[model samples]
Target: MSTVSHALTDSATMLRRNLKRMVRYPSMTLQLIGMPIVFLLLFVYVFGGTLGAGLGGVSGGRAEYVNYVTPAIILMTITAAVQGTTISIAMDMTEGIVDRFRTMAIARVSVLTGHVIGSLIQTMLSIAAVIGVALLIGFRPSAGPGDWLALIGVLVMMAFAFIWLSVAFGLASKTVESSSNVGMPLLLLPFLGSGFVPTDSMPTVLRWFAEYQPFTPLIETLRGLLMGTPVGNNAVIAVGWCVVIALGGYLWSKKLFNRESTR
Candidate 1:
């Protein structure tokens, strides 16, 4: 096969194997599914009403509070997928699975690409489910097709960035504990972003952070796509973030793999 064909074939094979492993551990699938759903219900029911009033009632009343928060939370589900990537990669390192792969003829990059692609596919499903629930609860995006497509483009780009981020953790970790260290900040992000509330409601300092954070652009871009509203200047910023992080991660991971192989 041509190099491109070979890479594609290897990536598919790797994805299938990883997915089979995901199936065997049904709980892994459950956590990915259940965790996002639970958060959706909690935020929409418990906090949505109060937060809606605070946003000047975006959906018009306390009853429609669920609509506005849906997109933010849906995008937030990637946190689970990305963090899961880090731990799984870490486990492979700790158990010597990755080291063993080095002795085989398998494509070196496929090992990372497969898991990243798998996680992205899983995250897409979770995002879809969250959207479905949001629609059922009366949320709808007014954004047109092109805008929606742009939203997905940014999301997929963000996924690539995060996958590389996960790979770096995988490369650096000597233990499983060390691998999972990116958790706290990722989980707390929705609270900090326009996820459940607008940036204006936050204190000046936090609003500044929230306004300037890379995630804010991502969330806004997604919000415009889903809600059919304008995302303002977030489009440029979001794409820029994706490019910088993905390139940086690729360069770092390439070097790390070379050293590990030489050892």
Candidate 2:
């Protein structure tokens, strides 16, 4: 078989391996999926009314807040799932599986490829579940079919970007605990951005940071796509950010994988 074809086949096999591992250890997957749902429920039920009132004091404040925050929660879902990727990769590295793979004749890229593809599938499923819960809880989006497709596209791109970065983090970390800690800053990005509230509501310096940060454009793009808000150049900016992140992560991951000795 051709080299590229061989890599693809090996990647597929590795993907299956990771998927099986996920099935074997359901707790980690459940925990990753559950956290975002908990956050969604907590924000919508507890703080939604007050938060929504700030957004022009819509009659059903909670309902309005639900729509406003669902996009952010969706981003969180992606972030949460990729955090698992970091832990899973770290475990493989420390547990000696990666060392074994390195000595084998299989395509070298397939190992990381499998983690990226498998985690992406898990992340997308988690995103779908979160969206379902959001809909059930009165989060109404105004997007039509095309808009929904666009939103999904945006999400996939964002998830892909984050997962690659997480893989890099995993490869860099010497322990599972450190891998887990690396993505905590990512979890905070949405909160610091325009995810939970309008950047205008934040202090002057804070608002400036929120406005220019990568997550702000991502959140704004999601809001525009899902809620029919003005998209403007947020889509372009979001895609640019994703590309830069994905490229950086891929390069860093390759460097670490090639140079770092497996624990």
Residues 1-263, candidate 2: write the lDDT tens digits.
99999999999999999999999999988999999999999999999888988887455589889999998999998999999999999999999898888888899999999999999999999998899989998988889999999998899999999999999999988899999899998999999999999999999999999999999999999999998879999999999999999999999998999886543
Q: Which ranges of candidate 1 are over 4 A from the true structure? A: 57-59
Considering every candidate listed, which one attains the maximal lDDT? 2
In terms of lDDT, the poorest run of 10 residues in model 2 is 55-64
Go through the candidates in order and give each one's C-alpha lDDT. 0.77, 0.92
Q: Estimate each model's TM-score.
A: 0.91, 0.97
For model 1, how does the per-residue alpha-carbon lDDT over 1-263 read when each residue is reduced to its tens digit?
78888878888988997888777876766676667778888877788778777666435544556767776776677776677777887788779887888888778888888888888887777677777776776665677788778767777888788778777777777888877775547767777878778888889999999988777888877877777777778878988988987888778877877788798
Worst 10 residues of 1 by lDDT: 56-65
